[model samples]
Target chain A: MTIPDTVEAREAVDLLDRTRALVQPELRGACDTLPGPMRRVAMYHFGWEEADGTPAAGAGGKAVRPALVLAACQALGGDPDRAVRAAAAVELAHNFTLLHDDVIDEDVTRRHRPTAWTVFGTADAVLAGDAMLALAVRLLAEDPWPRSAEASARLSDCVIELCAGQQIDCAFEERPPEEVTPEECIGMATAKTGALLGASCAIGALYAGAGEREVRAMDAFGREAGLAFQFIDDLIGIWGDPERTGKPAGADLAARKKSLPVVAALASGTRAGAELAELYRGPMGAAAVARAADAVERAGGRDWAQSQAAERMSKAVGELARAVPDLGAAGGLLSLAEFVTRRNR
Target chain B: MTIPDTVEAREAVDLLDRTRALVQPELRGACDTLPGPMRRVAMYHFGWEEADGTPAAGAGGKAVRPALVLAACQALGGDPDRAVRAAAAVELAHNFTLLHDDVIDEDVTRRHRPTAWTVFGTADAVLAGDAMLALAVRLLAEDPWPRSAEASARLSDCVIELCAGQQIDCAFEERPPEEVTPEECIGMATAKTGALLGASCAIGALYAGAGEREVRAMDAFGREAGLAFQFIDDLIGIWGDPERTGKPAGADLAARKKSLPVVAALASGTRAGAELAELYRGPMGAAAVARAADAVERAGGRDWAQSQAAERMSKAVGELARAVPDLGAAGGLLSLAEFVTRRNR
Candidate 1:
């Protein structure tokens, strides 16, 4: 079916689910090379098996990153199967970051389940993440594809940026809200969230023998989409349903997280923004959490973030149109971007 | 002058010192590409800077690993300069492991100074280590050399082994000594310590345009030397002087570390070994530490480790002779093995 100009939310979700099913087997196969214990840790993290190795119908991540890889390749007139390794590699690298990020952030729950660190211990979880990274690189290096070097280099560069972004994010936690600038927050989010997504699309283009210009265009598309995704994510952090996000209601406020929306609200310099900043400075009781959430929305944070996401998504679609020219070929990619930006609303 | 058949300890030390000086510049240059904070952390870890960024003659590590890379290249009739990138790559990867291992092991001191984890916060230290790993891979991948692919692959594989070894090491800490086999200890040591050394020599040989046989032989040579290095390191953990080693006396015993010698002692099935096991089961006071040390030595753990190291050194020298086909070219490698096997003593 040729997707329409505007994909419905139901259609986008179905497309993501179908692509995830296609990608999960490749992802699992990549782990087959890992050692026994490390493989178990990865399997558990992917929700392929329970901690004790029992089969469980686990909810893996959205698989949006890998879907982007395949969709970008297809849009560039390449076979999706040829880009499978790139897709799997991007997915592995993404999960590797998540596994380590959880340990570094001391987050206990992901996908409504106990984290890998909690189940396998910190050392094993961290090592598993390391192994996955190596595997990701190996997947690209070991592939017999001609452009493997370029693909690998792009992925490595993206990972370095991811690390830098994460470093800044962790540093931000120590700074007062007044010292944290919106530009800095956006830069960190770009590096942390955008770089990988951009690389995923760029790597797909490289595999499809796309020219440098098209590759760059695809990267720009993914980057803007990634930014939009983060905007919505930050919004959800402040107001997401606990059932949908698998996190506590107002969890970001309770933790006093300086997410993008919260940063924007604090930077607004309005009365509600000042009141929200005050609420953030003190210990967050149930009342304080609810009040902080209300204050953030009242300070124009919610509206600002929603508008920012919409603007970025519009730019992302424009980039995709520029790169592929044939809008029909880009339908899958566009819908995936829509799903990512609108999820958890 | 060509090296003599028997290199005296003074000559060996001079050779190591000279090569280390040559490699340090490349090592520092490699860090130039790191982001500011990460670069600072790396500089401080290498003793190039203080925490506040002031210059210091910090005690960097011995640089033995990089020396092996250059020496192996020269010994195999390749230009040492051609192997400089490989040498720096290996050193960076070694430091990467040290940075993370210190955090995972919760080790407070290294090379007589507070470890990177203690200097930087744990989160930054971990991220810094992650950056270094990416940088290491980038170094190999960016080099336009013909063998860069093989070298990069070797390094990635070695990193996987390192992670596996670390995982096993941490898992061992949770198990009783009796449940941990000597074979497992040796396997862990081989993976944790030997894989990188093997890859170092293999990469050096690769850069030198060596054949498969020569590369494998060089890897085998370094692997044996690495085993010898670990044996001596374990011995030092048990019996080295506090003045030179910069650790508390019998620190390994006090912490009940299942180092090779300790594992060997526990598996000895001798009376002194039994006493050591009994002592290990309880909290270690100063007296208990002293007695544990005595028991390890009396149970033939110390002697067994020494003999094993000597045997491995002999085998390493044999592998070098096989690879180079001229005992004269191998003198540097032989002396390095000797230095590593006898440093603490």
Candidate 2:
């Protein structure tokens, strides 16, 4: 079923809650090993502590990457407990990217609080991000399981892909609106968003003692689902409810970000596409942002992104079936994938 | 001899040149694998290419860390050729730290050229640095040698130490002149400079199939030598031949850096120490910088650092004896260590 029933949605949220419970203790244990100054920034960045060093309720990630790791391992009949460290490693890698990306983007707020860089200053934040990445590799490399080396290698490679993705995305911002192609935009999005998600699954499969074929299929499954999630996310960037998103409508357009749907609209070769590109050339006011959103829809970017999301989700299931022949066994992974795309709906 | 004889100095140069020849090909091959944008920044950072991406005579690092690795490998009676990738990995990790450090410190020059962050902008340099760090881990993790796992883990741990060191160093800049202790400065220097150098030797030993005792001794040797080098470097930062050092005399004093010797002088509890602390309270012009330099010397910082260097070098040789008792087997390693401390003279 393309649509998640209300009960299915509840199950997905429950799975995420269970993953947070399963993964947080080990994650905290790992953070405790950081040197004092770095430990302070990292603890605050993860929302385990306030910037003042007091405990907080922790508005960190939804643990999607970690959940995917454990779910993939369980789907393959592997003990999820054995993969907890790997799950934590994946989450650390994810947060490392977030910290650096925030500094690079100069975006201040994250998880409804100030970003690490804003609270700790850019130098401490950058150093903390670097430490988190090295910590991720250390956790995997120190594992007693022989296959952990492979997982570490895979994660490092994913980190490189992420840096490239973020680099390209930043480069895109400096170029003329018409200069970027939809293909290039998609490639950047895949590198930035999908690579780590896929790596999380592949690492999970490796920990489950899966061979090359199964691991590759699991990676493909996660990548497809991740892209699907990205498409939905980009849609929300343009048309998200201000109350729900906690930002203005068309916030991405206001910033003139070369997001997926906007890139599609710019390259659509319609009158609206040309108008949208013209509007992108200057600072956007509220009226301009609203008009830009309308032009994107008229240029067919909205329809295209929606259909692509649905198509990608379909492909994701196909890949999932290849990795896990028994669909029933993959319930957790399916729930996670759906939960990510179901956010806007 | 505390000072290198003419032949000994020549031998040290030759060993470094040989290490460069052996490691450059693998390092280039590894760098060539980076994505397009990152490859450009990394190439320029390593001085392999001009900013326009044209080939240039590289003015990169002196290949000190890689030399340590190969020399330590040979000293352990292992084939140094087998450790080339690990040597390259260590160098990559070193440069990764350099790129980010330059950004954080806002230093404009490195290796007598504009730093990567200055040339390519901060975001690209940071991304390139992130990629290089991952590439370092990837290089070791991909090695078929079973011991590469231990080496990779060691390198990751070293990176974390480096981050912590840099973080603390930056924090020191924010505190009052009298707030920091010399012991804390030494700890930061050991973490920042000594940890990676020690890791290089330890990893070399691991690749050579050395046991725990030999590896620990080798690491100690590198750490002591690294601290000695740091003391000499700090002395040069304050007082050195401007022509040879490629900067003004008292460069560190002018910048108000909380380098080791400066911290020592500030904590000296003497009249000149109070005068130096007063000078540190605000920005220093040329005349003020000269006065600060005189105050530090009058506070006994210069003599303290020189004596400490000699003491650390003695300890380094003692540690080297434990790792390679034959002594003759470690000629190259010994030469490299002596050459680093001999820079001031």
Candidate 3:
């Protein structure tokens, strides 16, 4: 669990770990308000408890969004303490989507454990996700800050977009791969992955009492970084080690997921791209998954995804620079953005 | 539809219809913010449009909760104009629950029309419901009024309870009728049905700038009335004319729903109760449904539910009296409560 000795790694790990530690108690406290049965489902989903209500060490999410919230607040020369509630709210909202998405996608496992639906049931998982969303809005509204209304509105709007993204993603499953455009896929990814991250940064900046322009700049910064994060995540879905990613090898390809890299490769129209399309049209086995990964690489999907990540990293950093002119106090934000794109897993 | 010439009925219908008219535009405005597909699903669910793009004169819900909101606001000596947003927000939240409940219950019809899931599919229905909920919270938060945070928090908390209620309701379906206690059924009904109604009145009171005691009394009033509403609804579900109810005859009994009256009958411990329990242990046909209805009545379940509704009605009136001592301008709320318990269907 020790972070590397590099300055950027140390800073990124410190900020992320610190934010997770700070937000864990708040998240657990929020779950306390759920009904008895639902509380168990939510607690298990958050990796705070086992299905039997026994305490267990668990690998929760990386708490990346929360780190961005607090780091944005601090980078804006504001008291990060004032934005703790906002950070927790963002994390709660993020987990809400995760729980429901698991149900919608019918995925049985998450974070190296059975998903909440498997542990409890579909009804319980759905309700737990719903309660988590309500709790997120409640947390923001309960904060007596002057701009609580604005923050809540922003969070709700982001949630609406997230729902829209998920709807389109589900709809794409009904369409032929050729019928799914790259522009549509990218828009869905932005709405699904980028919106919440953008809202997190914007909420933090709002709590920091930043001007509108600054808050928007922070939102843009987070949106770009979130896209980079998703691009890298899509790559990891196709190529990362199963042990590190906590999923099967080439899980996205096995499922024929219309991820960015796969879509780009399909759109490339190369010989490998055509072969990959033919393979995707059939049921996938171990060999098919392996061949699919090779074809994606041969069609330049991996390179395209990698370069786009780098491009998005620069765009994100530029946004952060625009928002915070000094850049001296932005080490955490800048390192976090770099870590998002460059992390192997 | 034309209301009766009676003074009480006229006033009640006027207020309810007026509130619906006022809230309709705001609801449409809110849906405009949703994405295209989701917006269409939501609009269809709300009876604003048919499956195609053509407009349809569909029958939406009765807008009972919105009526309570506006009535409470006016009875509290506040300008109802200031509380229009709160009324619309409550209606939005109520419909959000309905859309999800239909999906969860797998009900194919609502308001004499096809349920959203049957038309658009379950995923779209669920996402549309999620969008509706987010829109509810957004409506409250977008209000510049000082109590927007309080109203939003109340709505969210009520939604949490509603989810808990639904979770228990689904769980009850897995249990035998004899195993489902009347008390448990009542608690679930309160959480599912009473909480939002209570929140509705409390929201109105908050927007009215009422004192803490007044707000609490208003909430109590709505909770009592909401229980009575459910009790009456359970009765109608079992025995109401199918044409009026827009459902099959003896729908609840045929579905083996553990409604209040049926649960009360099972808990009666009379000879007819035992016979009814025996009948309920097997699958229900038309003859069985008819026999079960007779058995329920003979076991005093029908009487018990009726008397309980009356008791709750008085309690609601008492709470309203406590909140508004004059009871002069409170005729609208009192009449609405009377109509809830007295309606045949």
- What are the per-residue Cα lDDT tens digits for candidate 1 across A154-240? 888888788888889899988998578778999999999999989999988988899999999999999999999999999888788
Residue pairs with backbone overlap in model 2 = none
Residues B1-345 of candidate 2 have per-residue lDDT tens digits of 123466768788888889999999999888999999899999999999999999989846889999999999999998899999999999999999999999999999998799999889999999999999999989988888879988988998999999999988888878996889989999999999999989999998998899999999999999999999999999999898887776799999988888878889999999999999999887799999999999999999999999998999999999999999999999988998988877635
Expressed as tens digits, the lDDT of each residue in A53-142 for candidate 3 is: 999787468888888889988989878888888888899899988988898889898987899998898889888988999999999889
True contacts kept of 3: 0.82
Each model's lDDT comes to 0.85, 0.90, 0.87
DockQ of each candidate relative to the true complex: 0.62, 0.82, 0.86
lDDT of 1 by residue, B48-104 (tens): 888888998864677778878887888888888877877888888899888889989
User: How many clashes does each candidate structure show, in the order listed?
Assistant: 0, 0, 0
Error of 1 at B164 (Å): 1.5
For model 2 the local lDDT of residue A100 reads: 99
Question: For residues A1-345, what per-residue lDDT tens digits would candidate 2 score against the true structure?
Answer: 123467657777787788889989888888899999789998998888998999998846789899999999999888888999999999999999999999999989988789999999999999999999988888888888878988988998999999999999899878987789989988998999989889989998998999899999999999999999999999999998977676789999998988888989999999999999999887799999999999999999999999999998999899999999999999999988988887644
* Top-scoring candidate (DockQ): 3
User: Candidate 3: TM-score?
Assistant: 0.96
Candidate 2, which segments miss by more than 4 Å at Cα?
A: A1-5, A242-244, A281-286, B1-5, B281-291
State which docking tier applies to candidate 3. high
The CAPRI class of candidate 2 is high
Q: After superposing candidate 1, which stretches have Cα over 4 Å from the reference?
A: A1-22, A239-251, A282-294, B1-11, B239-251, B282-290
